[model samples]
Each structure stands twice: as C-alpha cells, then as structure tokens.
Target chain A: MTSSAQANVSSPVRAEKPQRKQMSDMTIRNLFIAPTLLLLIAMNVFPLFYSLYLSFTNYSAIARKAPVWVGIENYVNILTDPQMWQYFNTTGKYTLLTVSLQVVLGFALAMLVKEKFAGSGIVTTLILIPMMLSPVVVGLFWKYMYNPSWGYLNWLMGFTNPSVAPDWLASSWARKSVPGLALFAVVFVDVWMWTPFVMLLVLSGLKAIPDYLYEAAAIDRASSWFQFWRITVPQVAPLLMIAILFRTIEALKSFDLVMGMTGGGPGDQTEVIAVNLYRKAFLGQWQTGEASALAYIVLIIIIAISNLYVRYLNRLREG
Target chain B: MATIELRNIEKRFGETYAVKPFSLTIQHGEFVALLGPSGCGKTTTLRMISGLETVSGGTIHLDGANITWQKPGYRNMAFVFQFYALYPHISVRENIAFPLKAEGMAKSDVYKRVDEVVSILRIENLLNMRPGKLSGGDKQRVALARALVRKPAAFLMDEPLGALDAEYRESMRAEIKRLHLSTNATTVYVTHDQVEAMAMADRIVVMSAAEVQQVGTPADVYHAPANLFVARFIGSPGMNLLAGPRRGEKVELPGTGNIYTIPAPQREVLQAATPEGKNVIVGFRPEAAMLNEQGALTGEVYATDMLGAYKLLHVSFDSDTVVHIRCDRMVSHPIGARVRFDLDPQQVRFFDATTEKAIGPTQSAGTAPISVQAANAQEKAA
Candidate 1:
C-alpha cells in the first residue's frame, strides 16, 4: 500500500514537472532565492568590498578627482597618528564603561524580575521603554536634562545644595578638574538606554531554565547563595555573554547619542571612534580613504571579540 | 533514617485545593510509594514533604521535631526529579558531589562520597561526561546517585524513571528497589505506574482527586482495595466492574441477565453495608475469572489479546459493557462466539452503588476458600 502511494505521488509530480521542461530541484530553488541573494549582495557585500579597496587608496569626497591608490599609506597613517589613537582610546573607555555597566545592571534587573509576581510584567515592560525609544530622541532629551541651569537633574541636585551640581558638559581640561567626566556623562546616557536590551535577553535565558532544577537544588540542601552561583549563573552565562557581545559592538560604534548630546564637545572628550570617522569622512577634510581604513580596523576588532564569544557559547552548549 | 510525619497537610492554589488535608507517617528505612493518576496530589504531597511546596495548613515533623516552616535546604532531604534535573553544565562527578559540597563537606570527603555513589550506581565511566552526553537511563542513575551521595534523612523520588524506555524503566525499577534495600533510607516515592509501586514499595498509598483513597501494603491494597477508585486504579487492565441489582443472597447482572449467589460471608457484609432494593457493583480481577464448561455467566467474545503467557479475551455482554477474562494462551475463541465464565466466590468483591466503598467479605476471611464455599453452599440451599 505504501509503495503504491509513493508511486502515485511521484507519477503526478513527474508529469507536472516534465510538462514545463524539467528543472533540477537545486536550480528551481536557486531561481526562487536568487532575488534576495542579489539584494543582499548589493546592499551589504558590495559596500564591504568597495570599502576594502578604497582603504588602500587616497580618495577624498570633496576633491572631485579620480582616486589614486596609496598602497597601505592610509592604513599606515591612521595606525600611527596620535590624534586617531586618542579617539580610539576614548572609544575604548566608553565601550568598557557602558558595556560593563549595562551587563551588570541588566543581569541584576533580570534576577529581580525572574521569579514573577504581581505587576512584575508591567514593571519589566516599563523598564524596557527606554531601549525601544529612538536613540536620537533619548540623546536630545538627555541633553536638555543635563543643562546646568534649569534642568530637572540640576534642580533635583540643587535641593541638597546648588554648589554641588558640577557643570556636566564642562571639559575637564578647561575646568582644570577631573578628566573624562563629559565622556562619562555620555556613557551614562548610553547605559541607561541600552541596559534594558541586555535585561530582555538575560530574562529569556532565565525563563528557559526548568523550575525543577531549583527545587532539586533546594532539596539538596544548597543555600540560596550557593544555588545562585551553581545553578543560576552557569545556566545564564552563555546568554549573558551574548548580551555583553551585542552591547560591546554597539558601544564601540556609538555615534547618534554622542552627536545629539555633545557633538564631540567639551574639548573632544566625548568623541568616540565612529564620531571621529564621521568627522574625518564628512566634515572638513572628507578623507574617505582614511576613514574607511579606521572603520575596517574597528570591524576586525569587533569580529575577533564576537568570534571568541561564539566559541565560548559552543563550549557552553556542549557541556 | 528518620520518621517523616505529615499532620493534616494541605495545599491550596487560590481557592481550589491541590491536596486536601491528608496525613501519613513514614517510618525510618521504609519504602513508601504515593501512587495515583495525574492531578491526584501524590506529587504535591511529595513536594510538601520535601519543603519545596508550602502547606496551606498543618505541620510536618521530622523525627518528632516540627520543621513545618523550615527552609527546604534545612529540611535535610534529597529529591530526585522526574526529568533528572542534573546540572547540565557539570560532569556527573560534580553533579553527585554537589550536595556534599553544598553542606561544606571537605573536598576530600566529597570526592570519596561521590566515588562511592558512582560505584554503587555503576556509572564510573560516565563520571567525567556531562549530563548532555548521557542517555535517559544513565541520566536517571546520575540523578539517583546525586540524591544518595549525601546520606540525607530521607530520599524523595518523583517518578524518576518516568522518562525512560520500557526496558530501562523495568531495569531501573529493580535498581531502585535494590538501592533502597541496601541503603535502608526512608523513601517516599511517587509514581502513577502501579507495577512500579507494587514491585518496589513496602506500602502503597493510592490517591485520587487530591484525596487519599487507601494506604496499605502492596498485597493488602491489591487484594482488598478499600474503594472503587482504588479497585479501578491499582491493576493493569484494571478491575472489571459490573453494575447490577441485589435481592437478598443474589445479585442480578444487568448486562448478561445472570444472577450470582453472594457467598455467605460476603452476603453478611452486603446486608450490613446496603439496604434492600438497591444496586451493588461487582468487582473482580481478570485473573480471578475463568472459562468453564459449567460457568455461571455467559457473553459473546468481542476481542482477544495474545500476551505471550496468557490470552486476554474481551467478552461483550449487552451492547456496551465488556468484561475481560484471562485465559490460557492456547484457549482461542473466535469473535462472536458465546463463552461462559465463572468467578471464584472467594475472589469476588462487591461495592455499594452510591458510596462505591467495598461491601464484601474482608480480605482475611475471604482467603479461606474451602470453609467459605461450604458455608456459601449451605446459605444458598437455605
């Protein structure tokens, strides 16, 4: 009966295909998929390879001249320039501060909301509202909130004492005060906006865990502290690492918030690498080749970090 | 080992009770099984004892000490979950050693205890492998080893072998029974499979709808189920129940138009438990009924099942009612053939139609067949 059924199914299919000049299954599949593949190559791969070629040239947007191949000079110049290194340093510090704070705060929030009680769903959703808002909008409102004169933050600070409200956007060198405080202010804004993204990821990981594990741990006489370490942390670590990886890449390429809030103000203290690349490519010099080189460098670093995380994730899944 | 006592323990989720007020005492080193269908509060009672669930009322005692409100960690018991619940990130050795390490046992002692358990479970080669690499039966062994490594006051297993294949389930059933005997730890095992409960537990507590139906030794409960629920639940293919009217010493089978003479001892019990002009349900195990030439009941054979050692013949009486009769494997009756069967008077039990409680000769008095049958003949002649 099964063989007759198979033959019946195949006879109709064979007849249908042959009536229209038969194509191989792979060829038919490719015919359907080719349009999306072409679109992706045009949108993603074309720019990637085009930039790679431009990175070895001296192409300038404003010069209106044919690009000349510089033979790695753009790469050499960007790698050796101290000003470029300073921007990279600023980006490194900002990424470190924002990603670390986001991971810790997000994991803490996920832990708080993990068990689920009355109104916790609403509370979690409310906490995630900042992440859903436009980054430019967040930066614009936070810029206003940081105004030293009449901002709500200063007003709240002034309730205690007016003199304690330091100038939030003041450059440390100009004030002869703490350095990178303006950069910290920008990092703080990014942290507040993105911590919820990390929390959302970690919360899903927490929910994936079976309740029986905790019950087993409880009956095994493990302390709550020990259970947290042995059961909760190990189970959530792979997802937490994923959250960290995403936050790291986003923090490294941070631009919109810095552009809206500081625009590399306060003596370039808050100018991250992406903002620096933007300025070099679009502003005064329009050094497209050099900017592309810097972009490639940042991409390589991000890929290397992500690869490490993926390897660890595979090991975690295996274990 | 410890005496675990539950005093009127109950569990309520909002307004509905998950487990009604029930109490049972498990003596030290006893293997007791809470047997029931799903949603029957057996697992709930096990969790309440493990302190994983809070009781709505009543106190739980461990060795005569009240530990009702104590933390599960302090309750000093180990639980083996149905899904094994092994720490997936750790190796089998570490999983087994977790309870010991959690109690702050010295590292050397932890390794020693883990090694001993691994040997006992015969999982020595699986020690270094993570739980993800182990099969279902191996994972269950690892879970059991983890529960046993600490030598806690009691061990609570919640259908630990429920996930295994049938072959593994049978082997693991014997393994658990052997382990329970060697360890002699007080155990409260929960399972819906009566075969596992009968083969392993010293006492089986049958429950349904969050209430305890009966609690007794395996043989006691099997031979003398207290209520209709247990009579239906505790056996494979279950007990066959026939609803009929009872008049004096005889009960009329409604479907087959037959009357069975109630033996003398069972008649006395029926008279005491039921009033006149009422219906009674006759209950008997399939093995207790036999195909005979001069049998008292007759039915048409509807289906036959070859079970290797015996044949189970499903005989239809009336339009809808079917009664199973266990006959020798060689006894083949074609479909639509009329068959006659006889129920051993001593093996028959009767339940009141309304209350559903057993109304027949008690198990002890029913076991002496010669005297009971002789007396039953005299009563029938009278």
Candidate 2:
C-alpha cells in the first residue's frame, strides 16, 4: 500500500503480478461474464425453457391464473386442426419459393461483382440497403407498389400488356390448392430484401478460392462451363448451405411482411404459421396455450432443419 | 513428346517488361529449368509456354505450330502450381479424372487411366481420400497424377517443390526426374533453388533482372557462367570473384604485391578478349582453390564453417574481400590461420571489370551479353 512496502520487493514494477495470480481463472471468467450471462438468461433462456413448460399447460396471460398442466391437449388440438395444416403448407410454399430464388439470384449477383470495377463498392452498398431496412417497411412499400390502380408495378406491367397483368395481392386462399398470387407477392418482397445477405456470404466464399485453382483448371483443358460446375460451385457450396439454412428458418417465421401487406386477408390466403401464431397469442383468440404449443412446434421444426443443414455443412467441409 | 520453341519471347506489364526478349527451343523430352530469384520472370516464362500468360511480343511454336495466341485450355499443357491447386471438394480419383472427363472420356476408361497413373505414382491408397486429407507429399503426388492422367502435350511446372518441406522437396525432385525419364515428356520447370535446378534439369536457364544471363547444361553453367551475375548467382556460396588489373601475364593484387599468374589457355582467352593491363575479375568456385604454400595469393582464414560434407574457410585477402575455399571435412582451419592457395587453372573464369561479360575460353564461351533493360528502375537503384 505504501512506497516502503513496495520497496520490500526488488521489482516494484511487477508487484501487481502476485495480486493477478490470486484471482482464479474461473472466478475471473465469471466476474467478467456475470452481467451478460444474467441478462441473457432473463431475456433468452428463461423464455425458452418457460415456453417449453407452458406448451403442455393451459394458461391465459389476461386471466392472471397459474398455469395448469393440460397433458399435451394443446399440441393434440393444434396438430389436429386442419386450418393449422393449411397455414403450415402456406409457410412451406413461401419458404421454398423465397429461399430458392434468393440462392440463385444471390449467387448470380455475387458472380457479377466478384471482380471489382469502378463504383463496385457503391453498387454493393446500394444492394445491401434493402437488408438494412425494416421488414415491415419493405412489406408495406411492396404492398403499395402492388396496388392495382396507379401503382409503379402495375404501371410498368401495363407497358408489356395491361390485359395480362392480373391482381397481384388479391387472390383468394379458399379456392386455390396452389399458392395464391398474394403468397407469391409476399415471397417476391422477401427475396428482394434478403438476397443481399446471401450474396455477401457467397462473395466471401468466392474470395477464399485461390486464383491458381482456376489457372490449373484452364491448364487441364477444362471449358468455362466445366470449370464453373466442377470448381466454382463446389467451392462455394458450404457457404451456400449456410445462407439456405438462415433463409429457410427466417421464412418459416415469416410474420412482419404478411402482417404489413396482406394481414392474412383476401380470405386468409397468406396466413403463414407465424402470422397465425401471433393472432392466436395476442389479437383475437387469446389462446396462449395453443400459441405456446405452436411456438414449440416451430422451434422443433427449426431444430430439425438446422440439424439437417449442419450435417450437410459438415459433409461439405469434410471434402 | 512435345517440342516447344519461343522466338524472342518477352512479357511486359504495361510499360515495364517482366521478361526481356530472349529465345530458346526445348527439344522433345528435355527437362529444362527456368532458374532465377523471385520475380525474375521464370514463372511468367513458364506461364507463357503453358499459354496461361500472354507474351507481349514474339511467337510461340509448339511442335512447329504457331500457338502464340492460343487459349490455355486449347493448348493442352498441364501446369503444376507451387501450391498444389487440387480441387478441394473432390477425392483424388475424381480430381485425376477431371481433365479426362472434360474431354468426354467414358467412365470406365477414366477409371482405367486413373488406375494406371496412380500405380506409377504408387498412390492407390490416396484415390478415395479427398485432397484435404492428404499429406504435403501425397498432395504433390496427386497433383502429378492429375497432370499425368491427361497425358498433356507437355508439362509446365512452376516451382512445384517450393511449398514442400526440405525432406519432401529432395525426394519429390528425384521422383519428378525419374518420371521425366520414363514418360519422356517435354517439361519446363521453374525454380529459385539452384540445387534443385542442377539436380533435375537437363538444361538450366539462369535469368536475372528480366534478362537471360546464360542457358546451358548443368555442368556447363556450373563451370562457365556467362557473366558476373551468373558467376555470383549459380553456386551454393556462389563463385568467388577477385578484381585485379592485368600486369603482363599476372594479376596484380592491389594492396599486397602478390601477383596471380594466369594459366596459358585462360591467358590467351583473356588477352584476346581485353586490351593490355585492363582490370578484370577472376571467378573460381569454392572447390577450385586448394591450399598451396608456394601459391602467389596469400590470405588468413577469417572464419571457418562446417558444411558436413566439407569445410569452408572464409579467407580474407584485404579489408573488403573474403572468399570461401572448400577443404576436406576432417581438416581443421582455425580462424586467423594464414594459408596460401592457388586457383585451379582449368576451373578459373574471367569477366571484364566494366562490361561484366565473360572473357571466356572458346569452348565454354556463351553468346554475347544480353542488354539488361532497366524495366524496373528500383532494381538498378538497389
């Protein structure tokens, strides 16, 4: 504490080392991480496990009553309901359309700007703008653009032949087994907003491929088409899988875009599972028990998709 | 077998020439090495031959057909990169099959070719394993197999052993030479290591500052470098050079009154190449000097280095110059021990002090000095 005490040690500069050694690594790790750890448990972990508990019980937030175990009744009811099946089918169609289009367009765009040119930085920044925008805003903006009368989209379509331009977001869900125009419209907007993210990932993967590989391929007498399929595509596959995994899970939880544009309108044509879950939890039915069960079901589906994707990623890396 | 000829082949990047115009014809089945330090355009020259890099001027003839502007894939020359650029996602079998598959070869035929090639390389165990799982030596074997599978017109290897460990490089060098002996493929190898070039190449092309210093057989280049740069660059410790003005038939050592007598043949060659009493540099390899008490040149050992196979005495003549002399491995030459030595009359070389070109005897004399264009000004500055 004093200069005389410090003088007792020959190397006064390194005296702090002894005090540092007093703190065990475990205690130091906990000391630094305790705040973030507590906050994460309260915000993320508590809700996750508590929701798993509630998935098997009957409880209403508004009723202010303790939850009572319902013995998987909510799960049975939700799974048995044909409306829930329709909503899941709608989400699956949306995910399939959005993720596929995004992967193709993303990979193509990544290839285009792979070699830097003048203003490529500006072009990349412009492309990434949609991903940074609020999803609800994008959804609302596209809904306005899909307006039948005096909309930018319909006006542009009118040039090609106005007669062929059908209603964009007004198709009925009840009369069609195939996804309606409204679902396609929502899928289109999601592709527009998220393709850039996929492009960024693919671009990094492309950058990691050394130039000598291409030179060697050319020397081996491989055509450009052969090189693309044999070299470029395989090298970028792992990162592409990661992009697909992210987009699929995001599409499964599609809510904001549907809420902002169709709002499950045109006779519930675009009622994805997430939108239905929101309605059941908060808006109309106030069925918290069914909502929790649905949430768990979605979580399980995500885990399953993630498991398959992780396996694919591992296989890709192993090569 | 393929014959490749480059007529005045040179490469330029914008205004700077990466390789000054020079020409050489590689005979069928010859293993020619483009040897130089880094950025000396050896790799670029190899790339030009492979058609991966375009020549700024001059034409390339492959088997007497003009292929200067041919696309790399159409040329059918296999290029082995320094880093074995094996297709990472594919197994070794698929990688070796790739070039064949591109030509629309049948699946069974591809497998047969792969089997034959892998058997030669003794890498049958590696066929199913992906390239990532192979060791450095195994990866090199797979790369060689991939190149060999195509039976390409020629092989252009760009420092193929540069990335391997020292032990791997030695074995791989011998393996490549053995493969060349069997296949008899016209191979152009690029390397910075002189030992690798001397060990494997049928002819070594030494280049410096984007110009060809000399192109000759390994022994020829070893004994007869074309200029000062070649003399200084071609050996392990490089050839020792001592500059002195001619005094009759002897070279007058500047500070000391010691005079080195010129041998009869070299004396004739030097007198023919130069005016009387002109300053010239005498070049001799480390082994060319042997201890002689009655020898004209005298020096004390400044340092001693043990090279396992032999010993090197760093003999200091004056304040500025010290030359290495090789001796028997068991011999002891402590530091500061006074020793006199005589240069081997047969192995001694002469270079004009100003021009730096070799004042060489008729038999070992190379062509006139190539005008080294100052493509990069900084090189001259340094």
Which candidate tops TM-score? 2
Chain B TM for prediction 2: 0.93
The Cα error of candidate 1 at residue B248, in Å, is 2.7
Tens-place lDDT per residue, model 2, B200-252, is 99888898878877788787678888788888888889999999988778887
lDDT of 2 by residue, A142-239 (tens): 98888765568977755344344555778632333344888888888999999999999999999999998999888777888999999999999999
For residues A172-229, what per-residue lDDT tens digits would candidate 1 score against the true structure? 4223566777888898899999999999999999999889888888877888899999
Model 1 ranges off by over 4 Å: A1-43, A159-164, A172-176, B255-257, B360-382
True contacts kept of each: 0.86, 0.82
- Candidate maximizing DockQ: 2
DockQ of each model vs. true complex: 0.66, 0.73
lDDT accuracy of residue A275 in candidate 2: 94
Give the lowest summed-lDDT range of ten residues in model 2 chain B: B370-379
